[model samples]
Target: MSDTRATTQTVRYRERLWVPWWWTLPAAVLAALIALEVNQAVSALPNWVSFVVLFGVAGAVLSWFSKVELRVVARPGGGTELWIGGAHLPTSAIARTAEVPRTAKTAALGRQLDPAAYVVHRAWVGPMVLVVLDDPDDPTPYWLISTRHPDRVLAALQD
Candidate 1:
């Protein structure tokens, strides 16, 4: 006999939109080059100072470029939430959701896009999900979110 019960997992889906690993190579190299220039221009400063600047600039650049994350969570008590970057919305707020194929992305984001819509987009990630809001109190018409796996995102939200 099958034991029927609600899923115990709290996180339905999670993805980090990180910059490519090769990205760090160029960023670090540039930072190092800049630091070398600074060192040459200021010969009085300690050699270690240039290293510090290199690490600081590269760390900050990498961190800043790779922070967007999407997560779907099932609340401990009840309810579900979709988190895009830093913002979040309850699944109950979503009236409907649709996939925006790569071909139609330009149209969706162009003339048809609403000024008040909540959008978290990444250039590297193709395909997206449109979440139409039903909440009367909310002024935003909908949310356009970029996802590497739109199907997984849709499935997570549906569940």
Candidate 2:
């Protein structure tokens, strides 16, 4: 018998994308209007109260959707890693792998909005796989991961 031991069990890639305030202008405008109405009900509140409340809500919304990080790793022994956020999933916990296309508006606007310009443009561009993990406690059963440069992350996971 041979002796083999594993060191790291998981490897994840996490990144936060930056969203410009202007991208959220429409939502901000609506939030500001609603805040004004609420502020009027609280007449004792200062004039800056509405602005603070409006911005607070806007900031919260922006913060929630500002960034996306993708984590890809190898499973222990012969398993896959977990990927959350967007679709909430795991590599080995899935059966089917598909290419998800970006909506026209999202694509057009995203070109300008994507600071990293890592948008998935072509159908063949995605070698993304869906994993099906065996962990019952695990939440997601499937994860979408890029096939391009899979080794870069795969090697990282092995290390």
Candidate 3:
């Protein structure tokens, strides 16, 4: 038997671009129509209902700006990796891989010490697995990663 592993290519860095609010035009229209029809009923509904509706609207607006944009490139057999937005980092400096959960808190890479970060498509999108690095000489010590395919991305990086 022969070991036949495919040639390893550099994992391209991709910039996760935020989907503009305009992208939700259809959603807004739908909401508006529903709201118009439900306006009368809204008053009859419990106060909690209004709260939920408000949260829904706010969540939608936030989602519009939190979409992930990524930049990926061939690994080039070295530590250098460029983000889709043109940011670069060295894989050699990677401190560890932190598995992020899929939730609102995980969106936009929440504050440090936060185990999970939020992205635009928190529930719809795959959970992010951040590559924490030690930036001994810099203030930034971690990378916000929202790879399209987390398991595959992790596998490629491990290789």
Candidate 4:
């Protein structure tokens, strides 16, 4: 999706990362089971009411999970921006961009990461892009962003 904010600026790259189907399917199933258990525990409610509640809860959970998305947008005039859930980061303050291997990503997310760095991680996404912040005003040292296409993100950042 393109955003027409100004004439000079153009959105170069856009990526939206959502929870995969594998995760959503299992989450839905678990929600349904939990709803069933709750209905059994509260038997005073009518059967139809219980059924409706179960479906409603399960649907709501599924919708919430499905709607969770990590959006990355690169604008030429402005900078690269990452939107994960509700968090947003502008890459203009970024000093460097590095493509991290899967193993490196795993390690970085664990005990190897800087305490002050910001991380936008998704376990399912293997490759990641590390953006180091240069802005003196910002306290965050870097950002670890999970991306399927690291090369594209890197190129956009470099541009």
Mind giving the per-residue lDDT tens digits that candidate 3 earns over 13-55? Answer: 3345454446466655666566655766767776556545855
Best by TM-score: 1
Distance from true location, Cα of 68 in model 2, Å: 6.3
TM-score of 4: 0.74
By TM-score rank, best first, the candidates go 1, 4, 3, 2
Q: What are the root-mean-square deviations of the candidates from the true structure over C-alphas?
A: 5.8, 10.6, 11.7, 3.6
Please list the C-alpha lDDT of all candidates, in the order they appear. 0.86, 0.49, 0.54, 0.72
Where does candidate 2 stray beyond 4 Å?
1-21, 66-69, 74-80, 85-96, 103-159
Error of 4 at 25 (Å): 2.8
Q: What stretches of model 3 exceed 4 Å from their correct place? A: 1-68, 75-77, 80-84, 103-126
Instruction: Name every residue pair that clashes in candidate 4.
Output: none
**Considering lDDT, which of the candidate structures 1 and 2 is the better prediction for this target?**
1
Mark the 10 consecutive residues where model 1 has the least summed lDDT: 1-10
User: Which scores higher on TM-score, 1 or 4?
Assistant: 1
Which one wins by TM-score: 3 or 4?
A: 4
Worst 10 residues of 4 by lDDT: 1-10
Which ranges of candidate 4 are over 4 A from the true structure?
1-9, 62-91
Ranking by lDDT: 1, 4, 3, 2
Model 1 segments more than 4 A misplaced: 1-9
> Across residues 1-159, which tens digit of lDDT does each residue of candidate 1 receive?
012322553879999887777877888788788888988899999978987878887988778877988989897678899987768899999999999988888898999999999988777778899999999999999999988889999999998
Which candidate would rank higher by lDDT, 1 or 3?
1
Q: Backbone clashes in each candidate structure, one number apiece?
A: 0, 13, 28, 0
* Shift of residue 98 alpha carbon in model 1, Å: 1.6
lDDT for predicted candidate 1 compared with the true structure: 0.86
